[model samples]
Target chain A: MMRKTRFLAVFLMAVLTACAGAGHLSNWHDESMDFGAVKTVAVMPFANLTQLQQAGGRVRDTFMSMLMATGGVYVLPPGEVARGIARAGIADPTAPSSEEVVKLCGIVKADAVITGVVKEYGEVRAGATFGNIIALDMSMLEGQSGRVVWTASAEEGGVSMKDRLLGPSGKPINDITVQALNEIINKLFK
Target chain B: MRSSTSFLNRISVFLITSLLFLPGCASVKAGPAAAGPVVGANFRVAVYPVANLSGARAPLKETRRMLTEMLRAKGMAVLSDEELETFLARHRIRYLGGLSAEESEWMKGEMAVDAVLITSFEHYDEVFPPKIALTARLVSTGIKPVILWGGSSALAGDDSEGILALGLIEDPGRLLEKAVGGLSDSLTGYLSGKEERLKGASWRAVVRRGTEETGQGPPFYFTAEAEGGRVHIGPFGPKSYYEAPFLAPGKRYSIVVAPFLNASADRDAGDIVRLQFVAQLAAIKNISVVEPGVLREKMLTSRIIMLDSVSLADADLIFEGLNADLILTGKVEDYYDYQGPNGTPHVRFSVSLIERKGGRMVWTSDSSNTGDDRVVIFDFGKIRTAQGLASRMIRVIVEELFSGPLIQERPKGVS
Candidate 1:
């Protein structure tokens, strides 16, 4: 009886651990727009909605790195993006107007522009478990039409069973951020 | 079973206690605030001596030099220290503690400065993990000495061991450079009409706490807002300093290269400048520079007197005869190819450009070196030779002249 009870408890713990913060991801896109047509894209600075100072830059960098790693699209260098922003005299990089986006695309010779907002980032603790959470929403605007062709939002991160039971740490914030970015990029290409 | 239940209960209690004591990891971030548009396009700024309020001995002069270079790179005309000293001495001003209203007026009349940048250090340590806290204020020298912009920043040096593990140098100089670079970046970001969001706690509050602990007051006033561990400063308007480019980029223009007149005592300086000017111009794709031999032949055939100082009339006559779009003529204001006490090579010169038809002065650049310039190591390497320095200076001049909107060939179907 004790053996069976131990097995049942272990199984339940495993199930709870697997489901911890599985991440809710949703995406929207303009179906008429061809995702394959985007040959090059410029990732603008992301707006920060969280209290973390560098959350926007950190998430944007991770997303850019992951998107570039996929080799699906040519990503414009961040320095070039900065120069384009300066030349375009963008009042707000995070929320640039369609005109500014088109101007930036023209300056950097990108087919599309990617921008996003970092809604949540950093550590959160519940009960005895600690987790590093990141929530992000990204969108790609087509240069020719100055309209958003694709958008994706994802919130991910939760303490693993090992962290809760054994006091072992979960994945680093950067790793979690990368995972969240991969999910968004997967949906973006899909 | 009783023992096991007790063990589970203990574990549960421990988890609850840990949760109750969980530390808050919240941080604050400040973004750029909007400000009015910048008033002027060009500004001549004077950076006063940085007062050291940090009890620790800091390299104030080195920091000042670095800030000067940064400002110059941003296209600001920074008055050299020697010029400042000369002006102060001529005015019988023995000590420049701070800029009073009267002194500001005097500076305006004497130095023709548009702004005065005052800086002070509250904390600067050079230990294994260096720390630097600095405050800067840009005061306009207009009729009223209004504070155009202000900022304060604090930087804690990165762990040397960690940096070394990442395959980077962790020397004290590098740490200090990083700290100073951050401070300069903040200052320039404010001055150039961009907003810099500072992370971490309020540097002013931190300094105030330190002062409270040390039983002293902060050296400078705290005008910046600090809340939720973040300090928000200025948008400070757009960058006003402008250097007119000789010609806009992407357009091909024919230019006549005139021999540079030697104004310096160095006899070969003129030749060096002229040779470098022609060589660099030849390398630029958008500029079609007339060959030196061709230019001389044209001058001789056109009966144009090639004098040291070409007047507007002379420039017009030459332009009409040669049918060139622009004339590039300058004087070698100064040139020195010598090694410093530390075996560092140095080169300095000044050059200017003019439009041919209207004889309008378009661009001018002067190189200044005080032998105190810090050597910056990059992935590519450092400038080591006089020729390299000359080439670098010429590149800066060329970039300044041809700096504007980059012209791109639009696709057939795209606007």
Candidate 2:
């Protein structure tokens, strides 16, 4: 009887943990912001912290695709965003000042500007397990007030037990990146 | 039973891992959306030179040319570079920034334009994975030139690597072309109606209902007002000096040029006018023009020294002699190279188009550089000689006549 109870308890714990581990999403947003007023948004370059050289740009592209897919926003083109950055004379595109953000928004005629950082990306290996991973942090700043209106951070991807035991066939980097992006974007909408 | 329980545990672990790695389940609330501008067809607009802000040296002129073509394809009457430049110079407007109320009224009264379009390039590069970004705005030329419609778009080659790798886009130029093509489509779509896709790619746009003011709404809706209604009473009563009626559509007409009469003191004014008319008429695709050489030979052979205004009988005789549908005759009323006050050169001339069937006047128009017209600052005195003024005068007249609704339709499948 003791053994059976222990097994049942372990099974229930596994199920609950599986459900809880679907995503880890944390967000911070200013309550005073009128999101409805944000009709246009410029997506700025994302800072890359990973070893991969193109990780930042890859993640940024994914975020742009997902954000535009939401249909609630008119995402300015990346070239336009670069122009706005140049016109603002931002010394550091990844980390711009509040004043720079406002100036860029005004130049691009965007209601808000979205920026992000790619924390982790690419394939990883741990002993007998292997998988692709992606982690990102994103923020939205209002153009007029130059205040951060919304923010979200998320991390996704890990080796599944099935893959680990069955020979560790990892998912593609692009797939993992997209899944991680979707996870974080879901938080923004929520 | 023990072995079966172990297998079940393994299965459970597999299923749990799969579930954990799957996409997350989150719901999004409805957010705010933007509306596109509603504009009428055939609105006359002037596109200012694109302001290049891209740190790189991008081909701004090519981009402007592409934009102009796209606007024309959408049935908008875009002003030529010469015309716009002239207007700007005459008014002493150096910058293309937001126009003041007084400047806007002046443009409206003088140019008879409905809207002004301004475009700025934010980023443009032709390097590996070329990139381009631009923003455009259409402002009304009303009492206040408020922004009526605007859009911004950017695209990079890196964003389309998948398509490139798949051999969809063969070269960098093709990729840039695709990007600009998408931008143009999105812009035109926004102007005409709401597009379901936000960007030009596969992403679908969320539809928002109702007009929620964000302090960016247009001042007023635009209506299609009657165009080219201004009439000037020249020596003739209430004749069109700046506007001409559009020619009948779907008709092809052959034109025979008769030498214009040199009413001015300058000896070469008539020849200059004649040469300019021939050159301009040759550019019209639908109108078949008899070669100047052929017409000159025929005139010399017939001993026709027809000068000044040709009488109806003489016009009819020439029309029959040349087997022409229309006879275009003109008089160089005033051709003077003014060199003194304010340093502005002026040219004035009048032209009349006569139908061959009854020798009746079909169209008569005249223009003078010395009028109160606010936008005639082309080749001001120092740069303009008599020849230059004559060329400009003829060009202005020809453009006014041919660019109107008077155009022959191409046969099916030719375009």
Candidate 3:
């Protein structure tokens, strides 16, 4: 009887532990919009709000690379996007207005556009423990209508209990970045 | 018989001794012919003070001393620093970025200088993986100073890393020497009628993203070579339609590079990029890039200030002042260098070539890069400095701008 009780306790704890690394994810999808119609997509430079200098561009390039790897969508070249931004006279590429989005999409001939913001990137510490973290929020807009068809957010990496007790063995920033972006990408496709 | 044997032995000893000393005599005679400058035949080059456009403090004295020594080593008669100083002081010449027409005449008549070399120092970093960027142009010292030769380059310690980083350069002094040595070699090559040509190489990293319906295979193609490893998987073609047709075969054109606009955080990034482009453009045999100092002087005298993009009227004014066939200008979006172990340099910029006759953009290109862009593994192809990255980027863009079939029809307007 004691063994059974212990087994149940351990199994319950295991399930909870697995759920810890899931991070925070909030997603919105428009049921009225047809996602199948979207083909080529353009990713604008992400807006960075952290102390990290190029956290925005770095994350955007990684997310673009991962998205391109999935073979689910065609991502326009960054140079093409830059050319569109230049021609459209978009002052701020990170946070373009709906009208600018339509014009940029037309210029690049992209079916959709994705813009993102990096809230937190780099090592975060809670006194005794330290760990890498990345917080990313993205929105996909319909090229023709310039309306948000889908939006998603994801955060990954933090000080775990093992880390606190065993001391911090921080992961490479790139790995944490890939994890965060992968989670968001899965959510987008799902 | 014994006397005859003694005579033969003496003759044998004398012949061996003579042969041993003959090579030493020959080498002593060959030294000047092979390496030293020929008296009265060498070009008398006067290297001016380095123009600082880096927006930061540079080791100008040290750099100039090294460059002058290197130029002299290449069998050119470099003017002594003392003489150069005396002349500048006498003429009260504060600006050394370029020589004006009057100054050129003075140099030819009074100094008997055959050519004047103007240099611009762009970026110098003494951190790990030491880096240096500079451009030099040799112009004829006459009433009309025409650029006879020019070269711009950047060097970093970790640029040519081999297995386990065996080839990485860690000394800033060695790196500087290599950078200066390359320019001297190029100048000597030109003087000897052997123009250096760049081998064909593609700098673009294409990533092909095939849709699910196409049923394409893998997402990337990886190739590991002996020099530097590269991984590319993407659609093959031009990234954008930014370029317009440029250049006619067998025709030479003169070009003026206007100051670039800096949107990047780095100070004077615009000027750094402008000088880099000028350096690359001047090296082409068919194109003559005006000395940037000349252009700067003209702009100052004409009271022309370009707030943003160069206006049509401004272009006309520049054309009138320089009488050049084309005007090259652009903006630098990002020029950043990361520090520490995982650092990588990133640079992004765009350029456009405008026709003086019709005021149309004849060629345009946009380039962005990072040090770790295409490294498959082991960081073989990583770049460590923004200057080095910019040099590679500009070379590729210039090659595309000048090479290829001539397009007779006027390109459609950029939308």
Candidate 4:
């Protein structure tokens, strides 16, 4: 009975998160190259905005899962490209531009690239209330386009450490990601 | 044959019932319970040591000294480094963690010590301001080290540049003094109790309900919570003089809402007084809504969320910061007392809320509710219970303002 209740709770949370996602994603451009035509696409390293900060590799991992889970696409290894950048002695480890973007695609030999800026990642704590919010805006281009195609971004906002550890919250992190991914996918499809 | 079987069942049921009641009776028997002051054989602790974690050349002497002095002041016969070192050597104990019960027994046998306190300071480097990080802990033989208190504080040191450039505080003596003192006081209250058990791990949270600085019983204060042998409630950090003691975490506890009367009474009177206050506090939305804090997490989840609990000092500083949309205040007036024809006691309480803007009260609401109206009465005299009073108060207050429509916006669940 307890396990059943837990399962029901998770299902309910997913629904609520989907519901909340509709509000934040309203912009972006998806250059309509047939995603169906491309079996595998390479996602280049993302841009680090807002002064200089490292958000760990979780951001990259999240994008990988979010993109693949969208269907009709597959991602090449990010590790191989990271090695190429290292071999090339890239001065900046966090942010890469158009030239580096091209070089990265060549190293991985893939269809396209995705890149973006991390707008904010902060933890606001006051009294007994604690809130963690992470927001980023991303763009996907034909690896060499220098022309932006699909761009969709979303903000994950809310209070964590609530009723249950990793419980249903005002705004869940995963929900926000799915919302942004859906809107971006719509543009890609369009 | 049927009568015999029925009689046997009754006897079995009676025996089972007695087994349950006996524990309850022993719990409340009240025979000068001997658990407070950590006499000789207590075996749990959290030692938070804040030092230089930042790879800077700042002196950690003052912080280290403050720790030893503070623990000593708390009246625990703590072990010195030499003694701790010798004991560790004797017991062949290295890496102070991951010890089995047999290993623990060996250590205790060899060292004659049940637990040891270990802490380290992290991240001490600050360019303009003095940033200090401390980790305090208390570890026993088998239990994992619980962090009693660990956080970094930036004392406005020598940088006169103010907010742009935080200055390291010239003397952290006072700040350390207050933080330790508050922790000590909270520990004392938490440990002062008689314990009985049923279920998972438990701890006691005690907040002091009292008069304001104006000699009027309005704003409230809190003592730190003692749970599972760990103390929580940020050491009033830089604020020293208003410290409470270290607390004990026990499942069974008595929460004295308003101790204007005897704290020992387990009857309706105590609970009645508590309920009246809750109803009053809840009527004002900003004053208390969807209560907060991990320590107070249980309270908000309770049928009644405690509201009339902001002390004058805390409230004053909070309002002075000009942070809240509006400051709120509340008070309890006379209780309606009468005799029942059946020789039962009945009580009712009155309270009011005042909103503070600028320097004066801008809005006020008066409310009163009978205690016995909600819960049925069976006896007289000491007639209050935390649950009974809190429930009545919660019902009244939540209905008036805690509803979703009344709030500014639906608050996202607070972590």
* Quality class of the docking in candidate 2, CAPRI style: incorrect
* Candidate 2 total steric clashes: 3
How many angstroms is residue A97 displaced in model 4 relative to the true structure, after the best TM-score fit? 17
**iRMSD, model 4, in Å:** 27.0
CA lDDT of B63 in candidate 3? Answer: 79
What's the TM-score of every candidate structure?
Answer: 0.34, 0.32, 0.57, 0.31
The best candidate by DockQ is 3
C-alpha positional error of residue B96 in candidate 1 after TM-score superposition, expressed in Å: 14
Interface DockQ per candidate: 0.01, 0.01, 0.12, 0.01
Off by over 4 Å in 3: A1-190, B1-40, B53-57, B161-168, B197-241, B405-415
lDDT by residue (A109-153, candidate 3, tens digit) is 889999999999999886778888899899999999899989999
List lDDT for all candidates, in order.
0.58, 0.57, 0.69, 0.37
lDDT (Cα, tens digit) per residue for candidate 4, span B248-360: 23322111122212122223333334323322332322222211111122223332322222322333343433233333323222232222211212222222121223222
Please estimate how well model 1 matches the true structure, expressed as its whole-model Cα lDDT. 0.58
Isolated chain B TM-score per model: 0.38, 0.38, 0.75, 0.30
- CAPRI verdict (incorrect, acceptable, medium, high) for model 3: incorrect
* Candidate 2 deviant stretches above 4 angstroms: A1-22, B1-415
What's model 2's lDDT at B177?
54
Interface RMSD per candidate (angstroms) = 21.5, 28.3, 10.8, 27.0
B1-415: candidate 1 lDDT, tens digit per residue: 9999999999999986654443221111111121223435467899888766554578889878887887888777898899988977877764442454556787788788987776666455555344555555566674445444544444433322221234222354664566556555655555665642212113323333444457654221221111111111211100011122234323456776677665554555565555445544543435555544345655566676644334445567667765677777655544443322123334544444567644554433334332224334431233333333444455445433442111122123322
Which pairs clash in model 3?
Answer: B207-B234, B208-B233, B208-B234, B208-B235
Ranking 1 against 3 by TM-score, winner: 3
For model 2, how does the per-residue alpha-carbon lDDT over B308-327 read when each residue is reduced to its tens digit? 34544555666776677777
What's the DockQ of model 3?
0.12
